[model samples]
Each structure stands twice: as C-alpha cells, then as structure tokens.
Target: MMFMKSIFALAAFATAVYAQSVTIAAPVEGTSVTAGQNFTVDIARPNTLSPSQEVAVVIGLVSCSEAPFNGNCASFDVSQIFGTILYNGPYTPTLHNGPSPDFIDFYQNFTLTVPSWFTPGSASLNVAHVSLIGAGPFPDLEVKNITLNVVAA
Candidate 1:
C-alpha cells in the first residue's frame, strides 16, 4: 500500500509538470475533405516553454475505429492505416504574441496532399506531437484526432 501511494504521487507530479497541450486547428472535425486535394494542418502549442526546435510532429490517417484514445492501440494493426506521413521532423513553430504580455504562442502550419487512393469513407486524421521534457528519455506527447469524411477528387 505504501508503494502504491508513492507511485500515485509520482504520476500526479508528472502530469502537473507536463500539462502542455497540442491543438489541431485545421480540417475541422466532422468535415468532408477531398482526396488528392491539398489542405493545411495548423498545429498550435500555446504558452509553452518547451523549445520549438526539439518538438516534432507526425501526422497520418487511419480508420476511425483504429484510432488510439488513451494510449497506443491494443492491436497494432497497420492494415487499416494509410497515407504517407505529411510531416515528420523538428518543427520551427512560428512565435506570436500571446494573450498576456509575458506569454507567447507557437504555431506550425504545413500543407499535406491527401493520397488519392484513400477509400471514400470516414477516417481519422491523427497528429502526434512530441516535445522533449528536460533531459529525460520519456518525452511529453500529445495525440489528437479529427474525424472527417474522405471524398474522391
């Protein structure tokens, strides 16, 4: 029981330390996007002290049913996944004035050309952002999903 309590305390502390959030502002949820069309994905990480150069973003498409909610998918099936990585490298998020004079927001915007071979149906666009936390091996991550319909262009 003592060990469990200590573990809980550590988990809470970790959560508090890594409360940074990631937002996908483009391709609004539940909207329809055409395959083979180019669309911009606007990712924003506001008021974070994490270095933008140490942050990386990975964006891809997978079946809505296969999208991971809390953690990695229980079944690691890649058959349902499609589309090449839109962007997979360090991000130099744009700095902008924040709501308060002491804060600043970082925004990373990039264009992705949807694969023309995507089946016309519902799918989830997944964005995984990784930001290094201190010098630890474990990095802070945020995963977001936007469900949208894919139509043939």
Candidate 2:
C-alpha cells in the first residue's frame, strides 16, 4: 500500500508538471486509432502573465503514417508537413491585460479527420504555436500520435 501511494504521488507530481507546459490532449502516445476518424489536436496556453497582444499564428499538421513513424515522436519535424494553417489570429489568448500569469483562459483546438490517403501504419500529429506579442509570445510545441490501424467494415 505504501509503495502504491508513493507511485501515485509521483504520478500526480509528474502530471502537474507536464500540465504547466503546452501539451496534446488526445490521441495519446503508443495507442491505435482507426483511419478516416476525426481526432482533436488541442493545445493550451499558460495563464496570462501580463497584457499580451497577438501578432500572428503558426500551425502545422503532421501525418507521417508511412514507413518512418516507427521512431520517436519527437524526431518528426513540422516542416515535413505540406499545407496551410486552418486559422489565423492576432489576439491575446484570453485578452488578459492584468497583472498575473493566472488571470486568463485560452486554448487552441483543431479537429482533424485522418485522410483516407494516409498509409495505414504508425502516425503522428504535432502542434506548436508562438503568439507574437509586443514583448514576446509564449513558445509551445505539443504533439500527439497513434498507430493507424484499419477498422473492419
């Protein structure tokens, strides 16, 4: 029981730490998802530190479900994706023009339907954003990946 408690404590601590950074909210690592299914790529920004005005938005769609996704998820590059951003924004995440980092709420959500053309194998979705501001935008890179398996019709 003591060991279990300790493990749980450690896990909680780790989760808390990870949540403080930009992250992927679904299609978790090492799992299998069916092709042609829609999946979400959710990225969250840390609470506001100061008044932040946006300058631009950056987006990338990662779908390397071919023969090379067998390696580490971090090894993939956003440049390999060939496409355009689904949206463009230039506003503060939550428009928190106050004095604390915990003064606002903002997040990015993208709905992705796995293209039928993607090869059935290991696949990944990567996300990152830099919200340019008068000072400097928060830098974040997040990714989620799942094995691409065919579903029985």
**Model-by-model lDDT, in order?**
0.68, 0.47
Runs with alpha carbons beyond 4 Å of true place in candidate 2:
1-21, 54-75, 79-105, 134-153
How big is the positional error of residue 147 in model 1, measured in Å on the Cα after superposition? 0.7
Q: Candidate 1, residue 43: CA error in Å? A: 0.9
The true-versus-predicted C-alpha distance at residue 77 of model 2, in Å, is 3.2
**Predicted candidate 1 versus true structure: per-residue lDDT over 64-128, tens digit per residue:** 44335322333443334533566787766787876689877778888887788776666777787
Judging by lDDT against the true structure, name the best candidate.
1
Alpha-carbon runs more than 4 Å astray in model 1: 1-12, 15-18, 49-53, 63-83, 98-104, 135-138
Clashes of each: 0, 1
For candidate 1, the 10 contiguous residues with the lowest summed lDDT are 69-78
lDDT string, candidate 2, 44-95, tens digits: 5565344443343444334454435453345555546532343445323442
Report the C-alpha displacement of residue 51, candidate 1, in angstroms: 6.8
Model 1, position 25, has a per-residue lDDT of: 73
